[model samples]
Target: MKSLLLSVSITASLLLSPLVSAKDITPIQKKQLTEISGLLRDNPELINPLHSNLKQYLDGQKSLETILKTNHDYLYNNPQQPYFGAENPKLTIINFTDYNCPYCKRLESGLVGVIKKYPEIRVVNVLLPFQQRMIPGLKTNTAWYALNVWENDHSKFAEVHRLMMAKPSRHDSSSIMKIAELTKTQKDLTPNQKKMALVEKNEQIFSQLGLRGTPSLIIGNEIIPGFIPQEDLEKMIAKQL
Candidate 1:
């Protein structure tokens, strides 16, 4: 027993050795980080930082193991999952995004390639309900108008979303006009007065979610705030497959 214990200790130390980074990471490590982020909900200890006294299921589990047991809410009540990938494929990715978020735009840039890699994957998006609240005043109203149009006609939403992301302005008139042309909701869109009213309604739903910022993500069961590495996400998704 004594001999066996000594051998295991040696193995653990070697594996846990510090991961050195010159600029703090190698190109490969940097890349791995992108795809390695996973939902570790089932492994309760992960949430230990947030929840004290949580039991550890780690049991010498490697720092990076395919997390098999994320909370059901992570999968069931996901903010995004634009489509379904439950059974069709194991690689499913959801981005909980706001149109105005810079990080969300950054993530969007990498999304096209990720989708191409896994044809069977489902990349659903959960519209962050309160995205417009970041901007104040009439701009907020215009923001709501855009969202309403997208929600009312989802088929053309992807285009509208891209248009909103293209520019830096938040709920401005020029932006609204551009989106209107793309979605062509000019006549059907709520009048300016109605748009303002609509935004107020949307703000309530956002507040209820407890979302504090834009570009927040519900990757698997992992709640990653702001910009994240795509490679780490890729690895997490690949394991499921």
Candidate 2:
């Protein structure tokens, strides 16, 4: 059996899918191609004439790669939302994180620690929160509350992210205010009554994306679900780097 825990620990040790490299395919694409080729070669029943099919797939891949490489700018040419590393916009990582969720916080720290060690990497923070009816319009209404609290400030989001993973929340509004103060949240918007509608809209978008968990990440065209360790993330990041 595949070690589910090991996979989660490694994957959640942190994240994956693709990298924004100027040349070559992303890590996720490379891994996918490798797996597909392996299965095709190994399984006679799956591909009785594996060699013929493999060449065909490779040819198709090359054509697709060429087309994408030439047209990528037009394909994804939107002013992307940015976060922590916006000032240093080298290679960007878009993270949909929740502070209330423990795993999301864990992965956030691992990545942050990586950033501290390597300041060149740029990470964007998208405030995808997990919320509720009581705090109805905070953001996403899922288990992860920290992300909700984070909407008031991105840096606070990062701070609370680190705290929630290593320690339990007092699990109250006070915790929100405390983190807001500690992290110097921008505008004190957390206490604003009028921002509810905006928060609801944000939550709506999170739901629309079909995400049901904390830390649903987007790196280039790659969509990664859940938290992973730094080592796994580094393996993915190496391609872009």
Candidate 3:
């Protein structure tokens, strides 16, 4: 029974593959599909979970589409959001990131490459501190500090951003403050209420989009969740361009 179920699962995945269409179905795959159909007929319960999951996925996608469409200008053109790249960009990519997220850190280099390669592209950085619960220091966290720097001095924000992203591990309040000092943005170390409010707004947007993790990118109405290699990142950017 275990083997049968595994086979059915594998066959179902193959059926769902983009490369395998009805017209392109091979003989063996057709046989497996027939067997899967038989199994599903015998056990209707198996389809329930799959159906529920599919419905949930479709609902999330629809929600994301609506949010992106409604907040298009805010996501791409918000002056408050700290960004790196062309001052007047032909294209924009909204990056949702968390300082404590390793994947977000990994994505930084690829994102930098994209910015360099595409001179007309602007990458707006939205600091979404999803990992705040796990990390110490709520008010003076890295995300909040970065936002504070951006709000106070736009010129120094870039260096602060770079220093934070360059950290090998998760940043605590102390490390975040050190970055601010290094970048000469340590004068106003006190947590600003306005910055906190902006971070809260970003959290709301993140939840509305149904984003499960950090390192999500919004490019040309498409939300790509998680880290992608430089090559794939370039391809997606090219499509947007």
Off by over 4 Å in 3: 1-60, 133-139
Give the per-residue lDDT of model 2 (tens digit) for 1-241. 1353233323321222133343455678667556655654565454434444445545544554555465344222322232554355556676766545667767877777767765777775555446323333343232234433455454455555555445544234555445546766523423343344444544555565556776876554455788878887876666556
lDDT of 1 by residue, 1-241 (tens): 4443334334333332332324546576555444322322343443334222111223323222232233334433543224433346455565556676677777776666566776777665555535455344334443555556655665776677677667764556666666777677765355355445444433443344345665655454344556766786677567556
Clashes of each: 15, 15, 0
Write down the lDDT that model 3 would get: 0.78
Error of 3 at 65 (Å): 2.0
* The best candidate in terms of TM-score: 3
- lDDT winner, 2 or 3: 3
Worst 10 residues of 2 by lDDT: 9-18
Q: Please list the C-alpha lDDT of all candidates, in the order they appear.
A: 0.51, 0.52, 0.78
